[model samples]
Target: MRSGYSAAFKALLTRFAHDTSGAIALVWALASIVVVGMVGAAIDYSRTVNVKEEMAMELDGAVLAGARFLASSTDIDASKQHIVDTFTQTAALAIGDAADLKISPADVTINETEGKITATVKGQVQTAFMKVLGIETMNVSVTSQANYADKYLEIALVVDLTGSMKDPDGSGSTRIASLKTAAKALIDVLIPDETSDRVRISIIPYSQGVRLSSSDASAVTDGYSQRCVTERVGSERYTDAPYTSEFIGGGSGYMLGRTLYYMGYRLPDLIYDPEDVPEFYDRYGDGLGACPTEEVMPLTQNRKTLLDKIDAMSANGGTAGQTGIAWGWYTLSPNWNNLWPTDNEAVPYSNEETLKYMILMTDGEFNDVYKTIDITEKDCPGYYRRGCTSTTTKTWWYEHYNQTTDSSNRAKSLCTAMKASPANQGKGIAIYSVYFNPTSNAMAEATMRDCASSSRKFTYASNGQALTETFVKYAKEIQQLYLSR
Candidate 1:
């Protein structure tokens, strides 16, 4: 009976092993655990990746902020603390409870010599499904670097002080007053410390013309008495050529006299024969009145002088934007260095260490011009018989010359020339033009737009507050921060 029981048990075991239905169920049960673990691992990995991307973006922004702070702050410890705090706060807001983020002062590295700031951020995300696979957490790390380049800057602020600037803006503040506030704000940013020589600014406040110091005016005009000067006429009209006392009328007379008399200045009785003067010699009258009272302030690191000059600005006379543009270029052109004080001389165009910029602010159309006319002996009884008769036998005379179209054309041409970089040398002058409520003058708006280095550089401010904000924006742009990695 025992032998028969053993045989029956063996036969049952054999039948169980041969059953395919139960075999398939056993294999599927074993594989399902790995499949579920893989899916869960994938989901956990995706979550960690998302958190990593968020941390990277936030860290980039934080590093940029830190670089900017470092540029302005002398205390390295404080700047590092700012970066840590900013990254921590931003990561918390971005990743929330998804991960445990870590960033400390040690993680931020600043290279003062290279003007670089680097930051590293780390985060650990606890895995849910991956925990079953013996993985408790997934670690992620990111790094970002920023470079604050130390490049010198030379800026020319050519602002319009035309009669229209006296008009009230949308905020009930006169345009001139608003401009003063805006310009000072800009100065405060660029020239934070009075002794900083890395950045220099030249202020050219213009109405119908730009005013020079009596000495500078005399130097440019060969001892002309007026402090005001206009655009040069000739091949060098659009160039920043150094002024000369040499003659332009075939060496017969001094170019100085021609430049002065052709810009509506009445020649002194001692210099020219009164009998040779034409009947309409004074037709344009004296144009010195149209010159702005605020004189041009050459490249200066003195913030007080610049602000005071802007404060002294008053508006009267038509807009002669071309003249303003010409002077603006001269202020930054190394070719005109002879006229400026030795300490304030402009850097050479071949200087790769410096950047040149021009900020042109206007609120009206360019409608003023000092148009010249050549009067020969035939036109006038003795036009050039006296003072200017030796060579050309022709005298140059000027009038207010209300030619808006020509004035606008000249302004645009000057802008083009100023924007072109010196051939095979240093960088070009970047022009930033601001038009404040120029709704009535399409020509003015168009000219300003064309003058800007790029379409994005052109700005329009509808009110005083906007104008101030625009100036601040430009100042920040000029002092830009870059992400190196």
Candidate 2:
């Protein structure tokens, strides 16, 4: 009986071992390990993604900071270090105790030619749940780029040297004085020193007109030593062409009338050549003061001379903004390149290679001009030519030669001509206009606004401080070393 019971128990254990019903449980237990691993991997990957986003943001901040330093700082090595330190600080703020963050000098590149900065960062984060799956860490990397370049600049400053500029600008300093200071400040920023040739500046200080050397005026004609120049009679008046046959009377030229004779102290022919006087003035000397303003300084790199010229500017005449505009444009016009020194000659207009700028500033209205019509009649009120007038000094040639036009319209017409023509109209010159504390003459202000290349380039300064600020802003804009990515 004992042997039979043992045999039955052995048979039951054998049957249990062979049963397939428990196979599903073993399969499910094995699959659970894989499922847990997948979930852990997802969590680890998500954490890594967040870290990468933070790193991207931090890198951008770092590159921008670095690029700004690169733009303004002359020390490239110092600037690069500053950039790295900035990046490290930014990364630390986002990831505390990130002992594995790595950045190398080789990862940062600055291309001066392209004016760009590129930075690359790589790092690793130890996995938490992923480690259970034999994954010890996840790798993350980010890259960022920025642009910073300084371009070439050519600028012409057309300033009003009218008598009004002598008036107070409500800032303790006179308008002329403030202008000198602001102009000098601009020079300091643009040229800095004589070594900086990236910028060339020409200052055209105008009142009634732009004064030329007596010699230059004498060379324009045979007998007349013209001390003043009027707008050409027709279309040529508004063109960039040389002032050869463009004067009134279809360039018949200003023939000195019969009645107006010189005073007791007969000056040089260039100074006061009468109708009968021979044209003795030549072109080899300084300007004849024909269409006179302070002797204009053409586009020049001489910083000291420019500053000294500005210091010597004294305000004393009527406003002839058109004359100032004409001279300023001439300084930038390649057509008049022969009139300047070879090294200081104006560059021709280009589709992309060159940039030309003109800044016109005025404190009052346009109220003066050389002449608007041909002279056929006139009379001298006094024996001295200086005391003559159109009404009282009427001679047969008086009204004919003394004709005048609306000075404001004359200025506008000149501006229109300057801003028109060229491959891209107005592209040849980027015009900037400033009206300082204008009063009563809304028309003058409107004209000036229209003269600007666009409304965005116009500035109205109500006080001396504002004017100075305006000049500083202009200098910064002219020094356009912008950053790009």
Displacement of residue 441 (Cα, Å) in model 1 is 1.8
Question: Looking at model 2, which ten-residue stretch has the lowest summed lDDT?
Answer: 394-403
Clash pairs for candidate 1 = none
Q: Residue 119 of model 1: what lDDT?
A: 87
Model 2 lDDT, residue 454, Cα: 86
Give the per-residue lDDT digits (tens) of candidate 1, residues 150-240. 5677889999887788888778898988999999889877776554556789999887667777567657765533366677767788777
lDDT digits (tens) for residues 1-485 of candidate 2: 99999999999999999997789899888788788889989988888898889888888888877755543344567657877888888778886555544433326887777767888888888887777678887888888888753344568999987667878887888999889988988887676655344567899888655555655444433224354433443567677786554532111122333233232111122235333334422321212222333577889878898899899888864666776787787788887787677987877665344467788899977765443212222433222354235545311211121112466777777777777746133455778888887343576678679888888888888778888888877776655545343
RMSD for each of the candidates: 9.2, 10.5
List candidate 2 stretches off by more than 4 Å: 1-151, 220-230, 245-293, 372-405, 423-426, 438-440
Candidate number with greatest TM-score: 1
lDDT of 1 at 142: 89
